[model samples]
Target: MDLIDTHQHLILRDHLGYAWTDTLPALQGDFTPADYARLSHGKGVIGTVFMETGVDDADYQAEARLIAGLVGKGGMLGQIASCRPELDAGFDDWLAECKILSVAGFRRLLHVVPDEMSQPEGFRRNIRKIGAAGYTYDMVFHARQLGLAEALARACPDQPLVLDHCGNPDVAGQGFDAWYRGMQAMAALPHVWLKFSGITVNCAPGTASVALLQPYADAMLALFGPERMIWGGDWPVVNLGVGLPDWIDMSRALLAGLSADEQALIGHQNARKVYRLPA
Candidate 1:
């Protein structure tokens, strides 16, 4: 399969500041592009977009500059940078810097932050600016928080939004019932897209099985369809559960019934168009 991994992480322990890694001992080391290349060597990754690893607040610009410089490295296509949208007055200046970098979009880790963080007036205001600037923003929300994500997307209908991790559904604990409903509600909006990433981390130990994932995968395809769907490796993070190759194999299994063209869309084509990558 020809893949374009839209959510890979290149963790630089010394060069970059990842405050979040200190809490999670498993992800404390470096995951450079070379390491990723070796692991996914034969997985057929044709391109990739480097995702931010939740660096310290003060390191946002430095991290963006570092990741932005990695555009042509390995198979990297662009950077999905970190940003503080709630900084009402300073956000404009921050966004101006984003415009100057080689960025395809921006992502703030909403799942880990306070729920009210995304609901404030300042956050919404900045999201509007991102849309007006013609950049797509990625929403990383848990299943229970899907309502907040839906509201955020609805508040800015013009902004192109991508819901990361299949709404980050609780495939391990609650099954797919609640996530399915939330997904249906969000997919009703025309500007939304669903990213099929991060499924491994949330699934039960033995239940990363095809049987458990296939149903949820089918629902996403049925609701969002190929045109609004995209795939990502969610690397090093994928290391928390399954490795890159295993996840890719499982993704292929879950998407077995999809046509060749549909597979292409989920794997790379849709990502190319959404991220505006080179042909």
Candidate 2:
């Protein structure tokens, strides 16, 4: 089946600043659109949404513009640009720029920052502004930070929010019950969605096999159902452990029991709906 990758990441060394890469050894170099295309070819990747690589604050706009310009250069469907709502200075102007570039949504790397930062009045207010403008927000938080995710979802009830990496659960460490409960709580909220990506990257090395990833996938499929769930390759990050092709096969194995339509909903349909991608 063809797939629509909703959480794909790309790296451009010359144009964007990925200072975070110093510690991320597995992802230490350029991963351009051409690289992704080579891997995605015949893997059923019909289209993709470019996810931000958490570049330096100064490079946010440049990165978004660069990625946005790539939309039709390849099979890119759209981009989820990076934004800092808490900065609160010139944010409206920045949103106007995003609109001009035709970005599909925005993301702030919540996992790397202090939890308190997400709760400030400035952050909440800006998030509301983003929602009012009809853009989805990708909440990239760690497993322990689901409370923050819940709070943000509540604050921006009208904003579409997506929980990445199955809430970054520690499947290798067997941290299932806690994450499962967290997923259940977050799913209860009407506007929150979950992305079925990044499981291998979050699990302990050497422990991210298909068998291990299945439970987490099943739990998400059960709680969020096909409509509330979307799928992505997570691209270069998947190279850290189970590479893209293997990860795709593993995802298929985990979701083996679903019918064709249900599989399509998780793999493609839901992404277009959640991210407001073109048909």
Q: Scored by CA lDDT, what does every candidate get?
A: 0.88, 0.86
Off by over 4 Å in 1: none
Candidate 2 worst ten-residue window by lDDT: 203-212
TM-score for all models, in order of appearance = 0.97, 0.97
User: Taking the tens digit of each residue's C-alpha lDDT, what string does model 2 give over 24-83?
Assistant: 788988998889888878888899999988889889899998887788768788999889
Q: How many clashes show up in model 1?
A: 0
Q: Please provide, for model 1 over 55-135, each residue's C-alpha lDDT reduced to its tens digit, 9 standing for 90 to 100.
A: 888887789898887888788989898888977767788788887787899888899989999998779879988978878
Deviating ranges (above 4 Å) for candidate 2:
none
| Each model's total of backbone clashes | 0, 0
Global local distance difference test of model 2: 0.86
How much does candidate 1 score in TM-score? 0.97
